[model samples]
Target: EWLETLPQDQLKCLVDEVGKSGKATRTVKLPTGDEEECTFLPEHVTNEKKKEKQTTTTFMPGVVEPSFGIDRILFATLEHAYYARPKDTTSEDKQTRGVLAFSPNIAPYKMTILPQDQRITRDEKYVDMMRKIRQRVSALGHSCTVDDSNATLGKRYARNDELGIPFACTVDFDSLSDNCVTLRERDTMVQIRLSVDEVSTLLHDLCWGRQKWDAVLKKYGQSSQ
Candidate 1:
């Protein structure tokens, strides 16, 4: 009885292919506890004469969901960017320096400004300069941060590399006297000095791919890791 009351159109749709082959079996158990064999044939398929007059036609095709796994993509990206290097210390314990070599567009922050010493950052004058530099980068719609943490300058640079920061600018006592700062490439650990006024513009261009690090090396002397 339950099967008899079921929507015939939907049930027929389910077995349309089976009807064409005539090789499928369907068992129906009635409410009275008796079993019966049933053949499902949609009106369109069962009656050859009705095809010319049928108003509604449907196509059965499989569809797939299109949402790609973003988390997996991110994981793969980080894995590809993973880098390791030798330790700076003499103990011979392999100091694995892990770095994320993310493209500028994908990085969390475009650049990081660090004072060579946290002690310099404590001075009001250097703090103000760092603030202005940050403001300049922010005005260009690029994100940047200041790491005034107590970690050694080398350690801070290493930490930012792991986080995939593309560039780092260091403020030292010479920046106060010469109005310039040292810029370091995260992956290469190459250093170049540029005037504070021109640094932000250069950084914006570099991050946007308008300028390349090779140009900096050509213009300024190089420093190694």
Candidate 2:
């Protein structure tokens, strides 16, 4: 009833945010599956003074309401990013893999750290790095977990790859020695190795699609080697 009291700009921002969040609040259905209006009913007018103060005492027909579930948005992301014969896909100068491409704000982790030598190193270094990355992600209102259960680094990367984990940091023996790791973009088979401190921000940008592999490689010293 008092919604009109809200400032017009604030109302617009809210409507925009809600729309971007994939809310389908367009058509409201009645009891018989008929579309209903969102008309607001005003307080009844009793006294002559109240009636005199009122502009319209009755409820006027309103716009139709469109309401839907959050699941629809989730599915849309997966479907949009999903790829069949990924090598054949071409988008944004990158091959589309089975990525969820979720809005960065909701990823389980801004980045996932994977170690290439899972079998050779017994995944000790990779798992440890993943644990640290997971902690960092959680501290920042995100989450992460490792898939170091005797699977190939490729397999592990593929699993979380589809979960839309935007970035995966691959650690190797040299990574342990130099305190650095390689970053893999989920959508593209692009890989760039860098130091651990670089992982946090790299993850953030990848999740948001703000930074692409091409950009990361450039920032981290791209080489044709």
Q: Which is the leading candidate under lDDT?
A: 1
TM, every model: 0.68, 0.55
* Predicted model with the maximum TM-score: 1
lDDT of each: 0.83, 0.61
Q: Residue by residue across 81-122, what tens digits does model 1's lDDT show? A: 887866768766566789999998779899999998878977
What residue pairs are clashing in model 1? Answer: none
